[model samples]
Target: MPYLVPPHIPSGRIADGAQPALTADGGLCLRPWEYTDAPAVLAAFSDPVIQRWHLRRADSEDEALDWIEQWQEAWLAETGIHWAVVRPKGGTSDGAEQLLGRVSLRSLMLGTGQAECAYWTLPAARGQGVAPRSVTAVARWAFDEIGFERLELAHSVMNAASCRVAAKSGFSLEGTRRRGHLHADGWHDMHIHARVRDDEASCVPVEGAGPGAP
Candidate 1:
């Protein structure tokens, strides 16, 4: 599919362009973050499960707001894209703007025609297909509207859930590297998954592509 430069920005520049807000089942909308979202974003990242899964660092409310501000700048700069997974009012039993998660496409390799995908969801949002659904939505948009020929994602082997999200989003298991990153605990092995445009329909599975896919 041909990439559509977001209506608000030109093709080559990196500012003011954005992916459209996407609606998921249950009236959830994945839309670009706003400055007003700081509080909810802080609360979402403060969850122990998200911190453990993504190895998020400690931060004060001000620091968190700064991070969100930086993300906003980057999003408008067109260097990367970030979205907040919001559960709109009156749709869910909670009746709140549940900041379920965040997803991103970054590290664009224009020469190589590739980009990296990343995401993390609150524990309350896990096991409900949120991560996979969000990842797939972004991947599709990346290919169809962002002009990427391939997408890549990496996760520590211990992050079985993330690996599963990559698979369910259509990424094929690529390979593993030993001790690629040092996290809070120690060095950990990493698995790399990739999806190329040509293989979208027949990508091969990684180690756990079935019921044990994670």
Candidate 2:
């Protein structure tokens, strides 16, 4: 028996190539995480705000390195891709790239053409619109370049900041899932937001991103 619908995106399309760095607004760029960034990763996990949302902490430099290694390998496995949002060399006075936050397309389903977007900003990068810009950049790459049909972003209802980022990045409010996740504090209602490829409110034309402009 043949299936009625074929896969929207074929396997190995993305995994076959190196993960490309994406350009975002405010002179920020999203690039693959490197081993040398372990210290910054460790610092990010130490921040109370980041820890509260992330639910995991790096106990040592070794743990942070492990996490970075996992992120790098996930790209080749086609399960996920994580980008380190950074202020590239010229963007900072120190002339060295500065890690600002992280954005990822997790739970990626190539056949389904969907994935979940997740992000967190370091304490110093908060209030700079880093989260929203980074997310939009990745969405462009996923939708315009890789043919992803839909991308979803979910956050705890109590997280007003996440809600705002979703809105800013043009993700529409779908609904709420009661007790969607259990956090350290307790079970909390989760807000579900989504942006489809053809959505006018979110999907915009990617400059020089090939023929598909939806």
Candidate 3:
């Protein structure tokens, strides 16, 4: 019998195994989500802005735990990858694991050498360059370490902030997908941004404990 999944990625194509806890410059840490992070998870998703764009929203501690579990399950199946964007210990009142935001590579089709990227920064983390910095770090890991040939980022055309994130993190505007999908507010034209392994404008990976873009 053959494996049933389509756009199938043989195990060897994902030889990188589970996502590693990557350390980026400026004390940004991208690590697998933990059950203990539920409280912060609930807090971040409470923001109306996050609610508008994302499918997950956890109003209680228990719901937040469920959200974390899904990411864990997705990891085991190799279908998606998510990370908790946190800060160094003593960097904030929450200490080392301050949940700055999230960055993910989803809809993975390693067989096609590509994946989709999504990210959001907590309301408190805005204006601090959290999204761009963390995204660049994760994109670098996706390209240099995981060997993905192409990475994609798409957002509602009306999302100017997200557009900025895409640009600052080294993705180039590919084109528009007119009325590509419907949203709560009705259909939205999507702006697609992309970066390739060999792109001249590709972002450099974040280095630890130094002054570099992360």
71-148: candidate 3 lDDT, tens digit per residue: 988877777888998886888775554777888888988777788888887876776767777778887888887778
Model 1: lDDT equals 0.70
Candidate 1, residues 108-205, lDDT tens digits: the string is 66555677887877656667767667767777777776567888888888877777777777888889989987777898888899887765623322
Model 3 segments more than 4 A misplaced: 1-16, 93-96, 202-214
Badly placed stretches (over 4 Å) of model 2 are 201-214
Global lDDT of each candidate: 0.70, 0.84, 0.76
Among all candidates shown, the one with the greatest lDDT: 2
Q: What are the per-residue Cα lDDT tens digits for candidate 2 across 81-156?
A: 9999999998888798889899999999888899999988887777777888888889888999999999999988
Q: Order of all candidates by TM-score, from best down to worst?
A: 2, 3, 1
Best by TM-score: 2
What are the models' TM-scores?
0.82, 0.92, 0.85
lDDT of 3 at 45: 79
Clashes of 1: 2
